[model samples]
Target: MEKKAVYPGSFDPFTNGHMDIVRKASAIFDRVYIVMAVNSEKRRAFDCRRMQEAMERALADSGIRNCEVSIYDGLIAEYTKHHGIGYMVRGLRNNMDYNYEENIAEVNKLIDPSLEYVYFRADNVAVSSSMVKELRHYGQDVSSYVPPAIAALLADGNTER
Candidate 1:
C-alpha cells in the first residue's frame, strides 16, 4: 500500500510556511494531499476552487510532483479515512500552534484511531496565513511569504498600493 498523507488547512493564501511542510511531508510519504479546508463559520478571502487552483500551480512551479491539491468541506479526519490516507501532516511555529493543533489531533484521533500525524517545525516562524493576508490588506509586498502563484493571486485584489 502506498503511504499517503493529507495536509489540511484553510491555506487562505498557501504561504511559504505551508510549502515548507508539504516539502517535508512529500519527501517521506509516497503522496501528499494539500487539502484546502472549507469552514463555513469563517469568512474566507478566496473560494475553495481558487485556492486549490493556485496551490496546484504553486506545487507544479515548485516541482513538487507527488503532491495533489484538493478541497474538503467536511471533517478532515473523515476525508482521510474515506480516501484511505493513513497520515496527516501539520506544521508548528510555536507553543500556541502546538496547543491548538494538539487539541484538533486528539479529536481526529477519536474519529480515526489509525490516523497518524507528522509534524514539521516552521522554516520561518514569523510567517503565517493571517500575517500574509494582513500585509496584503495594507498593500505590502507578500511575495516573500507565499509561493509565486499565491502571491500573484493576493496581489490581484490588493488596491491599496
Candidate 2:
C-alpha cells in the first residue's frame, strides 16, 4: 500500500518553514497532501484556489514531486479520514506551540485511534509563517523566508489585507 500523509495549514503563502516540512515529509511518504485549511481563523487575502496555486508553485521549485496541493474545510481529522490519510504532518517552531498541537493531536487520536500525528521541528525557530506575514505587511523583504515563487506572488500584491 502507498503511504499517504496530510500536511494541513493555511499556507497563505508557503513559507520556508512550511516548505521544509513538506519537503521532508514527501521524502518519507509515498504521497504528501499539502492541504490548505479553509476554515482557519486567520483569514487570508487569497482564496483556496489561489493558496493552492501559490503552494504548487513553491513546491514545484523546491523539487517536491511526490506531493499534491488541495484545500479542505471542517475538521482536519475528518478530512484526513476521508482522504485515506493515516498520518497528519505538523511542524513546530518552538515549545510554545507544543501544548496547543499536543492537545489537538490528542483530540484527533480520540476521534480515530488509527490516525497518527507526525511532528517536524523547523530548521530555524525564527522562520515562521506569522513572521513572513508581518514582514509583508510592513513592506519588508520576505523573500528569504519564503520560496521564490511565493515571494513573487506576495510581491505582486496578492496578499493585501
CA lDDT of every candidate: 0.88, 0.83
**Candidate 1 off by > 4 Å:** 158-161
Leading candidate by TM-score: 1
Q: After superposition, how far is residue 13 of candidate 1 from its true place, in Å?
A: 1.0
Structure candidate 2, residue pairs in collision: none
lDDT of 2 by residue, 42-134 (tens): 777655676678788888777778999988788888888788999989899878778889999999888777899889988867887788878
Best by lDDT: 1
Each model's TM-score, in the order given?
0.94, 0.92
Q: Tell me how candidate 1 scores on lDDT.
A: 0.88
Model 2 CA deviation exceeding 4 Å by range: none
